[model samples]
Target chain A: MDRFERQHILSGFGIESQQKLQNAKVLCIGAGGLGCPILLYLAAAGVGKIGIMDGDVISLSNLNRQVLFGENDLGKPKASVAADYLRNKYSDLEIVEIPEFITTANALEIMSDFDLIIDGTDNFSTRYLVNDGCFLLKKPLVFGAIYEHEGQILVFNSAKAGGTNYRDLYPNPPAATEIPNCNETGVLGVLPGMIGVMMATEVIKVLTGYAESLENKILFFNSLNYQTYTIDFNSNPELKKLIPDTFEAFRAKDYSLSCETIPSVDWDFALSQQNSDSIIVDIREASEMPKLEREEVLYLPMSKLLKESKSLLAAGEVYLFCQSGIRSLKAVTELQKVLPGKSIYSIKGGIAAFLSKQEESNTYGN
Target chain B: METKEQKISVRAFGMIAEKIGSAQIQLIGISTIDELRESLFDQFPDLKNMKFSIAINKQLASGNAPIPADSEIALLPPFSGG
Candidate 1:
């Protein structure tokens, strides 16, 4: 018996549609709650090539809804774990694992390989990045996001001509702390799974033409009362101008929550550039530990650094780092106002990212 | 002709509904998206900082378009959860 025998026997979704599922390539971003089911069904339906891109690791809390992994898979990279699950189930399935988060530098190159992109990420920055990247590449995108008991799904860039993108729906991102995510608000465990299945259905519809796709329409679903609303929208010409004009400009654009744009570098770049021309400053408070013991690394905390920003005028370039990348990015935004002419860069993942990378390398090297 | 303040039936969803303390409500004399926003903010001051889109009769409004009398309005905020 054929593997897709059930789908092949269907009247509308015959072998032709089954083959479309086998021949099409799809890339899914974020292997959390939504990504779990999206990946499972896509692979089970015989999607030829699947790409899983996520930078998060599985924690104990995620076992409730991220159904792909078990307790044994804790502390494992989501992309690799999900890819491995699909590969083991379907031997012929082609799976590509990207163990890094999507960024401006890598968005275009990573998205160019697939026919469709599914965004299940939990942040506004990555959602906008994927939306803009799909528009730039002219690829169909299935976007799904959730909050508590409600979820929203939209199929963008698949309308054959001019259609709505995410920006058309929300021209501007919400302020950093204005809107809360599931982390703060808390979500029902089954909410994302239900929404994720709908997102996957949309992907199948778009690829195989089994049904009318959700193009130009955004569906809002509330599982509590089983209420659903489908709203029609069109691409705004004025909003299209907000996207970068070219690939180079897109790469240079800042997708962070803050309006202030700052260049960010990895730990390696910050470490290598510790010279007389460029100085490295630890922006974390004096109480923070696991501190860098290098003589060249300065220990000026962010609180006092703002007041005495001019004290480091002699250095041609300034590199800032903190416990995590959040504070460092904010510090760069503040310091830029004080020292307008100086070059300031925030270390991408701060000390935590560097420590994790070192641990991974050690595990692999052994 | 006598002037009557027509009411618009507004339905809020997700965070917007949570902030307003109800999923459904009625607003009087709201003829445009901006006016509806101002009235909502006047009532629920917490909504001033929240981000949401206004849709009239199930169609997303890109600008401050005029709202017809007795239109079915909805307030939708972007959901960031996966």
Candidate 2:
């Protein structure tokens, strides 16, 4: 009795389907909540080659949903940690650990190697990046995203022709400020597990030719209500024009600029500029947690900061940060307009980046 | 021409539900996707700034497609989480 013997014995799935699973190469982006279950089932079902790509490290907050890592593995890179655990569990699994996020510069080069790509990332920038990259490469992309108790799953650009991609559903990302406060509004732990398994089911169907995969369709599921809706979508030629048609155009496009106008600096730069002459304004709302206790940092929500941009003219350098950096960039764009010659920078990845750095330093004693 | 009142049932999902304050709503005098959009924006002004798509009778609705009488319409906003 082998690990996939049960699946192999199913009516339509046999040794042939098992062979297909074993021969397939899939790249799963983001080893977070959804990535954990997607990777588990895909490996358990005998996927011969899998690529785990995530630039984030394990944190205490992630333990509840990221099932692959425990407290003992805290502060370790997600891609490497997930790869090591899967390798230990399965002897023949070929795992590629990409301990980095996929950017326009690397998306095409990295994604071109896989038969399919699964997007389990949490942010819109990466979501659009993965979808556009797969569209350019002509690879099947299994898309899954969660919001509180609800999750959305879809298979885009499959081997089947005339299917719609993510862009068709929402041609442009919602405004940065309009996006829900995800960091503050938490997700139900089991939501991703349910949706991830569904996404994995699509991957298997798409790869093995077992059944009808979710090509040209989008699924919406709410765990609280246990209600599911599968809607059919068609390619929008106008929306298709919004995506880059050629690889060069794809690489040249600034995907992040859709949310961020100015390129942000890392913790080092943000820290270096934190002096009496500079102001470190926290742009998160008053209720948001892990509030910075530093004396140099000022607490000003985005709403107040944008309205009060003129008052910051006296500050030497303005460094803004929000929970995850999106709002701060919006703030910088607004501030730059008011203070043309002034240096207003956004701390990339915001307080999350700062805290992750603290976690890394605490773990390594650097 | 005799005037007939058009009432369409709308189902909101994801963020749209939170914004609209209900999972489902009865929109009156809306006979097309464009009309439904105008009515929703008129009723919930915040929705005008928000991004969402409509699905009429389970098919993705685009370009002022007619809302069939008694059609089940869905308001879906893109979910960015995972």
Cα lDDT tens digits for candidate 2, A283-361:
8776455677798888878768768876777889889998667778777877787789898888887776677677679
Tell me how far the alpha carbon of residue A79 in candidate 1 is from the true structure, in angstroms, after superposition. Answer: 0.9
Clashing residue pairs, backbone N/CA/C < 3 A, model 2: A146-B81
Per-residue error for A139 in candidate 1, Å, reads: 1.0
lDDT of 1 by residue, A127-245 (tens): 88888888888889999999888999999998542557999989878765464544445677799999999999999999998888788888999999999998888888899888887
Would you list the C-alpha lDDT of every candidate in the order shown? 0.85, 0.85
- Most DockQ-accurate candidate: 1
Off-target runs (Cα >4 Å) in candidate 1 are A259-366, B1-4
lDDT of 2: 0.85
Poorest stretch of ten by lDDT in candidate 1 chain A: A176-185
What candidate 2 gets wrong by more than 4 Å, as runs, is: A161-163, A257-276, A281-317, A322-324, A327-345, A349-366, B1-4
